[model samples]
Target: MAQVGHESHGLTKLEEGFRYTKGISQIPVKSAMREGAQALESARLEALRGRPEALADLMYGGRMGNDEPGDGYKYRGRGYMQLTGKDNYRSAGEALGLDLVHHPDLAAKPENAARIATWYWQHNVSQNAREDVTKATRAVNGGTNGLADRESRNERWLQTLTPELMEQLAAGRIGRAVEPPAPATPARTAPNAAADGVLKAGEKGPAIETLQKSLHALGYTDGKDRALNPDGHFGASTKEAVQAFQRAHGLKDDGVAGPKTLDALKKAEQTPLLSNPAHPDHAMFKQAVGGLEKLGPQAGFKNHAELERAAATLTFEAKVGGLERIDHVALSTNGTGLFAVQGNLNDPGHHRAHVNKQQAGEQPLEQSTFQLQQDTQQRQKLEAQANPNQTQPPPTRAMG
Candidate 1:
C-alpha cells in the first residue's frame, strides 16, 4: 500500500527545492500532522531511517497535530512535507492513515514521514530514484529550478544513505561510503580518460570509453573490469557510478545523467564526500538537453516525454521525399565533432547539411569538446524540419 501511494506521489527537487525535472519516487510526510516536522526532518541527514534520531523525532515532532483539513502549513511546504498550508495537510493526511483535519502533524513526525517516504521508495521512487525524482519535480514545479520543490530534503537524507545505511556500519568513511562493487575477479583494462579519449582495448564509444577511463583513473572502478573499452555507450557500471555521483552532488538519480554526473563522479575520485555536485557542466548539460527538447515543440514529439515535459523527450524523424529517413542518433559523447561526410546534398542517400567530422592534427579530446558544441546542429535540424520551406542561406562568414 505504501509503495502504491509513493508511485502516485510524484517527483522531487534535485538542487534544494527548485523545479520538478523528473518524476521519480519520493518519500514524503503524508499526514498533515507530520508535515511541519517532516519538512525539517527530511532536510536533516542525521535523522534518516537507519539513524538513531529517526525514532526520537517521531516522538517529539509527531505530537503537534493540527485541526484544519489542510491547514498545517500547506503552502509553505505542504503536501507531503507539510510544506505550508491547509490543502497539503488534508491531502497528505487523507492518503495516509491519519486525517489531516484531525491530526495535522501526521507529516511532522520524522518516523511517520520517513515511513511514508520509505513506502514510496520501496514501491515507486526506488525503481529509479534519479529519474523518478527528476520527472516528478518537473510535473510539480515546472522548469524554474529543473527539480521538484523538495531537493533540500532529498539531498539531506541522501547524504546519510551512504553504503552504511544498508545495515552495515563501518568505522570510517571508506567503510560507510558506497563504493563500486569489488571485482568478481581481476580488472582487465587499465584506466584511461574522458578528456583524452584514451580507452583500453575492449572499450567502444569515445564518450563511454572516455567516461570509463576517467572513472577508473579517478578510482571509480571495480577491482575487476579494468579492461578499457571505449564504445561511448553508458552501461550498467556507469549507471551505478552516476547514482553515487548524484547523491554526493545532490542530483536526481536519472541514469541518463551527464556532465554534472561526470563532475560528481570525478570529484568522488578526488575528495570522496557529500559535496555539492552542482557544477558548470550541470548547467551546460541542461542547456544542451534543453536544446534537444525544443526540437519536439518545433518538430513535434510522438508520445515520448516532451521537452515541455522536462524529461527532454525529443521525438524527431528525418524524412526524404516523403519517405522517413533513419538519421543516426549521435550524442556529443558519441565523438568530438559533427559526423562529417563529403557527399552531395542532393545525393539520393543524404542531403546537404553542415558536416563537422574527422580532422587530423587535433587531439581527440579537443575534438570531442568541439563535437559537443555541435548540439546547435540538432537545433538547426529541428528548425529545418519545422520550416522546411525556409530558403537555405549561403555561408557568408569567413572561415576561422
Candidate 2:
C-alpha cells in the first residue's frame, strides 16, 4: 500500500474513485520521496531477472523494445500508483498540463502523481465501476494478478470515504452493513409487444427495422445472405444477429432487443465498438476479404446476398479483435450478379476473415465458404416460407 490514508467524506463518486484508486489526495513532498523510492525498489526487483528490458516489455508493451537503453529505468513505474511507460508519461503529462515526456520524474512528484493516477481511473474505469470492481482492477493492472490486494485496498478505503460510513464511525456506531439490491436479469421486458417494446423474433414494424439498421451499423449483418431487408420484421435472422452482437459485447446472448441491449446499441452509435486500440493490418484483411469475395453468391434465387453477408461477417470479425474504425469498402467490378460480390473492408488490425455460409448455426469461420453458403440459403428459404409476406426490393449498391 503506497501512501495509504483517509479521504474526505464529501467527495463525489468520481472524486471518491480517484481517492480510492490513487490512495487519497496527495502525499507530502518529503513523504513522497520515501514512497517513490519504495515503488522504484519494488520495480527494480521485478525487473531484476531480465533487467529493465523485460519490465519495459511488461509496462510499455514493447513500444521502446530496448531501442532506447535505460528506458526501462527511465520510464519505470512511478506516480501515485504506477504510471509506467513512455506513452503513459506523455499522456498523463498532457492531461495534467505538465511536460512529463521530457521530465519523467515529474510524474513521480506527489501532486502530479496523484493527478495522473486519478485521471487514468476516471477515464478508463469509471464507466463500469458502478456494476463491476473487476473491470476497474483490470483497467489498471491489465488482469487480476493482484486482485486480492486491490479488493482489500478498495474495501478499506471505500469504508472511510463514504459519508454514511464516516458519520457512523464518528458516532461510534459499528454494525453490519445493509445488503445491496439484486442485479437485474438480461431479458426482454415485454413478451407480446415486439414492435414498440422489446423487439423479439417475428415482430414486423419500423422499430424492428431500426434495430436491424443499428445492428448493421455496428457490423451485425442479420441480412448478410442478401440485402438487409430491414423490412420491419424480426425473424430468426434478426434474433441471430442480435445474439451475435450480445456475445461480442459480453452480454447475455438472449436474442432479444431488451433495454440493456438497446442501451448498448445507443452507446455503439456514439462510440466505436472496439474498446482495445490494437488492430490488424489493412493488406492482410484485404486478402482475407478477397478469399470470401471469390466465392460469389451461392444457390440463391437472385441478387448477391451472400456477398453482402460475407462482408458483414468479416467486418464483425475485425471488430472483435479491436478495430478502431472502418475507412472504406472495396467492392468488385461485377454488379448485382453472383460473381459481383467481391469486396474488402479495411482496418488497422490486418485480420484475415473467411465467409462462413453457415450463418444459421454455431459454426466457426474455419469451415469452407461453399458449405456456409449452402447453410445460409437453406435458412433463408425456410424463413421466406414461414413468412410469405416478408419479400422486399433488392438493395441499392450501397455497402454499410
Q: Evaluated with lDDT, which candidate comes out highest?
A: 2
Q: What are the per-model C-alpha RMSD values against the true structure?
A: 20.0, 20.2
Cα shift from native, residue 177, model 2 (Å):
26
lDDT by candidate, in order shown = 0.36, 0.49
Best by TM-score: 2
lDDT of 1: 0.36
Off by over 4 Å in 1: 1-75, 78-85, 118-133, 139-400
Instruction: Write down the TM-score for model 1.
Output: 0.22
Q: Over 4 Å off in model 2, which ranges?
A: 1-61, 64-67, 165-400
Question: lDDT by residue for model 2 over 155-196, one digit each (tens)?
Answer: 545644677667777877668575554686785653444535
What's the C-alpha lDDT at position 251 in model 1?
A: 80
Clashes of 2: 14
